[model samples]
Target chain A: MMQQTSDKKWFDELVVELRLRQVHGSAIGDTVASARELLRDTGQPAEEAFGPARDYAAALEFPAAPGHDWVRQALWPSLLGLLAFLLFNQAVTAWTQQELLLVSPAQLALLATPVVLVALLPLYLDAVVRRLWVGIAIAAICAVAGVLSAVVAPTQPSDAWLAIDPSPWLIGTALVMVVLSVRNTVRSSRAADDDEIIDPLSGTTAGTGAGARILVHVTNWLFPVLALAMLGLALALR
Target chain B: MSTSTPDVRATDGVDWPSDWLRATLGFLALRALSGGPSYGYAIISELERHGFGAIKGGTLYPLLTRYEAAGLLTTEWRAGDGGPGRKYFALTEQGRAELTRLSADWRRFVASSVHYLDPERPEKEISP
Candidate 1:
């Protein structure tokens, strides 16, 4: 049981290390299967047989896909989705109150905190993945910034830096979120876009079960779902 | 322990320095594959059987992977009988040529080192 747990952890670390190195899914799957084959033959623990997972991953040095490919494919879409979600959250409250959405410079900076943090993720992604505390700290910072942004929101239009009608912003942001979710849903359903681990010998992919599909859909639609919940909360408060 | 067994000597419980293994394990591994296609454990076993200390999977797989990437080796996956499939690695023609060259060079280097260290050699007597 202990050995299995440790081996599981080792495999998890290996996956993270390989992903950080920008190795493609097919190659990662092959490397994993090969390692498992040796472990089964020798009946040795993964770490014992294959040094540190990070070191092993680095040593393989598989030909990675272009570095910025992920940024273009995944990150930009996510950042855009996040921007839309934040705008929806801000607009929903004002729409519910039938007032213009007012924003102060302080509130804007505080609101930008999460977006900036997420934008800078590529820089500290290694630290975030390797250390639990770093991930937790980042989450906490984003959460606090969100709450402080709300607290610093201007009550009167005269004190605000920008005052805009909430109706268009609310509808526009919601549409953006839904459109992006649809795009993601379509992209994810395509077999070529899926990166499930594959069996090298049989050439069959693993981890494409119903649960995985559902999880992928949920992730794709996450921003819209959260925006809807915020709309509900705002309506209730009103 | 058996006279019938070829005198393929083990390292006799003495651990070879890591530097020595790191320096030679690459070509040694290619030479092991020269016999035919083999998997990770098989390659390690062949090396251990031939008197090299047990090579860890960590050491062997990375070297093989790099060789595969360099086009010196090509890999195939064969299904095991009632078990998981195995990834087999076979040397390419380039790999075979590299192995032959490295083997010849290694043999000459070893022979020169042995001659230099030989107690009966006159060169040893004149050494400062």
Candidate 2:
């Protein structure tokens, strides 16, 4: 049982390391399966057979996708979606209350905190993935910023830095979020998306089951669903 | 070019320095594959049987992966009998050629080193 757990952790680390290196999923799957094969054959523990996962991943030096390809395809879209979602959150309450969306400088800055942190993720992404504390810290920062942004929101126009009509902003941001979600869904559903790990022998993807499909759809539609929830909360509060 | 004893055995009781193994494991691995396509454990076993200390999968797989990327090797998955499939790695033509060249160079270097270390060998006449 202890050996199985250790091997499981090693394999998880190996997958993460490979992903960080931008290795293709097919190649990652092949590496994993091959490593498992050796372990099964020798009955040696994963660490003993493969050394460290990070070192093993580096040594493979598999041909990676273009460095900025993920940035262009995934990061930018998610960033845009996040920005849209934040804007929608801000505008929803104001629209529901039939008031202009009043923004204080402090509130805007606080609101921008999560977006900025997420935008800069490529820099510390490995640290965030590898270290539990780093990931927790980032999440806490984003969550605190979200709560503080609400607290710092202007209660009246006199206390605001800017007041703008909320309806157009609300609709625009919602549209942006929905469109981006649709785009993500389409991209994920495409066969050309090589993100799914495939079994080398069977040439079949690992997580193509119904549950996996639902999870993928949920992820793709996450922003839109969150926006709807926020809208419902705004109406209820009003 | 000698197919006999394709497995290179280390001298008895003297472990080759890791630096030496690290330097030569690449072509040595290619030479191991030169016999035919082999899987991970098989390759490691061949090396270990020939008295190369156990080459970890971490060490061997990466080298093989790089070789595959460089077109020096190609891999195929073959189903095991009542077990998981095995990834078999075979040398390409380029890999074969590289192995031959590296083997020749290594032999020459070893011969020269041996001759230089022989105590009875006469020193060459110096022009100066």
Candidate 3:
């Protein structure tokens, strides 16, 4: 007797195996199996039966974590704290100088402090594994900002661009933000699961998931663009 | 390839265990497909029928997948014709050749052992 079997039977079997493993979100193995059976009955190969199954598995196994969300969470609060600290310091300094409270670039940065600080709130909850690279970048930026503030702080008021001098206290605050940001980001990245192959420290593809694309998107576009905007704002006001 | 060479005991007189058990399983799997393509459960039951009940699902399933990947076995999906789904596996020409060679090795080993250890004794010379 010829034993004719349909391809759908084999596809159903594969579906059951994948379900037994609990591969993805809550999947009904029997239902998936039945669907596979239907496909096979139509004269499809086993490969055809499994295409959707593979995609569903990939999505569950690798969830994306956007870089902007991570950076904002970690750095926002710290930025606000620094701004508040700077503004308060400026207010006291201006009072001692007997000058009217005015919006200097430093004072404007001080006013923006709360926004920066609130932004840091998100960083607190982030896994250290996720923020190491962003932290490093922030640290580098702060160090450079500190050096510029210290060297260029003007002793006398002048209309010339070179007359401005950044206070040492302001420079010191930037350095502190840099150090804290680097520390938190590194700690968070290392604490995350090893399965996440992207190194949070450098925002680069370490190995696993869709890490390569996320890293490229973050490093080549997001952070650089934000950093450029920040520089432009500071230069324009100065 | 070096390990699979035909030398056997001819190699420096080393007494290799020869992994005979695994070879036997592979040989049986190949022969089991000669009747028709079968699935995991069918293969396990066939092995059980041959008095090799130690073969379990965990061992057989991985082995089947590995064999399919190695090109010694080919599988096709069969749907709804049976009550549920199943992946039916068939032996390839390479597997058939391997089974023939392994069967020959088993025969040679058995014949040599029986002839050396339990050679036929005359009825009158048999000890009580």
- In model 2, pairs of residues that clash are none
* Share of reference contacts found in each model: 0.94, 1.00, 0.06
| lDDT values for all models | 0.89, 0.89, 0.48
Native contacts present in candidate 1, fraction:
0.94
User: How far off is residue B114 in model 2, in Å?
Assistant: 1.0
Docking class of 2: high
Model 1: per-residue lDDT, tens digit, B1-128?
11123777755454789999998999988978877888889888778877788899999988998898899999999988998889999999999899889989999999999988888899746669
Error of 1 at A230 (Å): 0.8
Kindly provide the TM-score of model 1 when superposed on the true structure, using C-alpha atoms: 0.95
Using TM-score as the yardstick, the better of models 2 and 3 is 2
Q: Mind giving the per-residue lDDT tens digits that candidate 1 earns over A56-149?
A: 9998878877878888888888999998999889999999999999999999899899999988988999999999999999999999999999
Best by TM-score: 1
- Docking class of predicted structure 1: high
Off by over 4 Å in 3: A1-238, B1-20, B81-83, B119-128
TM-score versus the correct structure, for each prediction: 0.95, 0.93, 0.33
Model 3 Cα lDDT, one tens digit per residue, B83-102: 55566778888877776887
